[model samples]
Target: MAINSGSDPMRFSASIKVVLKDGVLDPQGETIGRALKDLGFESIVSASSGRIFRLDIDAETEAQARKIAGEAASKLLANPVIERYEVEMAK
Candidate 1:
């Protein structure tokens, strides 16, 4: 849970992006990249895949919302062993 300094939080938006860790194998991304090349897309040399989750949150403040969203990202949105996550908040 996020530590709140006050009550009656405002609504905010949160986004969680989950991507494969560095040095990890991403079969889906690799296959997509190959397909792009086979389709005469030479400019697409490095194509990677990731997951994005957009959520609406209510918290006491932006900081609290960020903290809560980050915790959710780590625990539910991403796999700690093979994937990394980043959480962002929107107005």
Candidate 2:
């Protein structure tokens, strides 16, 4: 394939993982664990809530795509005080 121009948009795929920070209470996770135990899931012990987002971005470069996704995560996808996020980008 021919190389794309600097201005040409390239397709990039990204996966973002957002989770609550340590020492934070996750009532929903605890509830899920309780429900699982009630359902005879003996191995169920602890649970934690987290979110993953898959995004397809059109940007000039992989770095740009990563920056965009990171900015989104920092601004909206996760809370700086209570949550942490990881962004992985691929072409």
Task: List candidate 2 stretches off by more than 4 Å.
Answer: 1-6
TM-score of 1: 0.88
Q: What does candidate 2's lDDT look like per residue over 15-40, in tens digits? A: 99999999999998999999999999
TM of each candidate vs. truth: 0.88, 0.86
**Using TM-score as the measure, which candidate wins?**
1
lDDT against the true structure, each candidate: 0.89, 0.90
Model 1 agreement with the true structure over 1-91: per-residue lDDT tens digits: 5565555779999998999999999889999999999999999987889999987888877998899899888888899999999888876
